[model samples]
Target: MNQYLLNGKLTAKPGHQEALAAILFQASKLVATAKGCRLYVIGKDKADSHSVYVTEIWDSKEDHDNSLKVEGVRELITQAMPLLDGPPAKGQELEIIGGTEI
Candidate 1:
């Protein structure tokens, strides 16, 4: 199957990286049981202290989009808004050709 992959970056306001990471971590929990969710890994950017990255894999792009409807997701998004340095940049969408089991 051709899986959907997204690499998203979020830049927190000064001193809010931990807070933003916390919110995203909470979101990871909320989506843990979401349909088609395979992997959702959070990472910190070594060069940019304010940046956090979320890498996700889903069965399909539709499944990824539908994840937004999962319970508490919207709320988490709302909670994350003010912590951002500015509007988030679009996530990088990747076409998965091959990979080891997730």
Candidate 2:
């Protein structure tokens, strides 16, 4: 099976980190139900309270792209925009070499 990974950061506007994290956590639950989602983990940066990190593993690149189309996923993205400090952090797409099963 083809596997894809996304590791990125999201910076929240001042005093909005907790709110953003909550939204991300909610999105994680929604992503868990996605067909090809293997893992969706969200983390907060200790040094920067306004920064959040996300790590996702999908069965394929297509799966990852399609996830964005999910209604709940889309809603979360919309809800997060206003809390974001700027655009989401740029991330690299990696072909998963190996990983433990979810």
Candidate 3:
């Protein structure tokens, strides 16, 4: 089966980039042992000080969906909501074909 990949960006309110990055860092830790989790990486947008990007790879689309139910995830989402600049953009979903192993 093809792997599921998601590339998303979250824009934090002014002066909250660090705060938002912290939340996403927490999420990465929480999902480290979750079933089907492959990669959960966080990055900063070079030109956008307020933007944080997340790249995730999972065994399947279902695995990614089920990640939301993992313990502590919902709470983290709630915490992050107030730090956001506005509604988030929909993440880009991709099907993995091949890639260099990290």
Candidate 4:
């Protein structure tokens, strides 16, 4: 099986983790039904109360890229941009070496 993983970090304004998390959670609802999306998770940084992370697993990179073109997802991205301290940082793209689901 082929898999694509993306990790993104969003630094929210001070005391805005809850608001940022809410948007992320709402985005997750849309991602949950996205084609080829395997896993879409949002988590808070353990040490930083104003940071949030999004972890996504997809069947392919193309599927993941296509997701961005989705109207709802695009809207969510727009909504999330202002809440972030800066541009969302992109992490390394990882190949799934192994996982319980596989």
Candidate 5:
């Protein structure tokens, strides 16, 4: 099995902090339970409400691809549409073998 990760940075629309947080909260929940998902989280940038981070883990590239077809995943993306200041960027990743604790 291969694990896949996505790291996204988001910036909210002007004066839309609350809206962005609300959507992020709901979308986190939606993504956490999506098929093939191992983990999903939304995090603040520590500098501004407009800046945020989203990290996700999937069981495999195929699983990640399949999850885009899930209803919850679709809804989460749709919910996020109005809150973003720019298009999100994502990366596929592999973990470094020695970078974890037992």
Candidate 6:
């Protein structure tokens, strides 16, 4: 199977996790239902409440590339950026694993 992975963390203002939660929930649903989306997950840092991480995968590189152009995905990121206290650091990755969930 073809796959894609991404990781990012954002620093949000205190008491704003709830707000971020709403956006994340909506974004997550949009992403999870998107064409070729195999998996998508967002996780908050246990040690730092302001930090978050997402891991995602698609059925193929074409599907993955197309996902970047999805309007819902673009809107989600746009809506989320203002909530951050700092620039988000992100990295894209290809699958190379024992095949267990991350």
18-100 in candidate 3: lDDT tens per residue?
Answer: 99999999999999889999999999978899999999999999999999999999999999999999998999999999987
Give each model a TM-score. Answer: 0.96, 0.91, 0.96, 0.91, 0.74, 0.75
Q: What lDDT score belongs to each candidate, Candidate 1 first? A: 0.94, 0.88, 0.95, 0.85, 0.71, 0.70
Best by lDDT: 3
Runs in model 2 with CA error above 4 Å? none
As for model 6, its CA RMSD to the true structure in angstroms is 2.7
How many collisions between residues are there in candidate 3? 0
**Tens digits of per-residue lDDT for model 4 on 37-60?**
999899876788889888999989
Candidate 5 lDDT by residue in tens digits, 1-102: 556777867777888766777777777675567767877777786678676776777776677677677667677678777788878655546642443421
Between prediction 2 and prediction 6, the one with superior TM-score is 2
Residue 96, model 5, lDDT: 24
Clash counts for all predictions: 0, 0, 0, 0, 0, 0
Better of 3 and 5 by TM-score: 3
Stretches of candidate 5 off by over 4 Å are: 95-102
Count steric clashes of candidate 4: 0
